[model samples]
Target: MKTSGLDVAPVNLTHGPACATCNGPTRLTGIEPHPMRPRTDLQTFQCLVCDGVQTAVVSLVH
Candidate 1:
């Protein structure tokens, strides 16, 4: 699915990233290119069970 022009994919709870605070499965809520890094992405996730939010910076492989 797409959100505000950003592509967001549905996450499988059983394999998705878990929340650090509650260990609950998180869904990808937002993503964009990192401001300071080339070929890198900044992603945001929200815990499905606890509504907790987290951000991650991932380097692109190619």
Candidate 2:
């Protein structure tokens, strides 16, 4: 599905500790607002291993 130029798809992530700095798996915290879609926020995840962060823009369609 799609909405307002945002594509709705399964947001999956695969990550692991690349080094000793990173401990374990990553975790999702909250959503962030997009520049175009002020009402929408993208899903954000943080890596436990390397403290790396990732964001996935998702469309909330009802």
Leading candidate by TM-score? 1
Best by lDDT: 1
The lDDT values for all models are 0.80, 0.62
For model 2, how does the per-residue alpha-carbon lDDT over 4-62 read when each residue is reduced to its tens digit?
87565654455422323455676666666777985567877787666777676766655
Clashing pairs in 1: none
lDDT of 2 at 10: 52
Question: How would you encode candidate 1's per-residue C-alpha lDDT over 1-62 as one tens digit per residue?
Answer: 64697455554534458898899988888889999999899888888899998898988763
Q: Which 10 successive residues of model 2 have the least lDDT summed?
A: 12-21
Clashing pairs for model 2 are: 22-49, 23-49
Query: If candidate 1 were superposed on the true structure by all CA atoms, what would the RMSD be?
Result: 5.3
lDDT for model 1, please.
0.80
TM-score of 2: 0.49
Model 1 misplacement above 4 A: 1-15
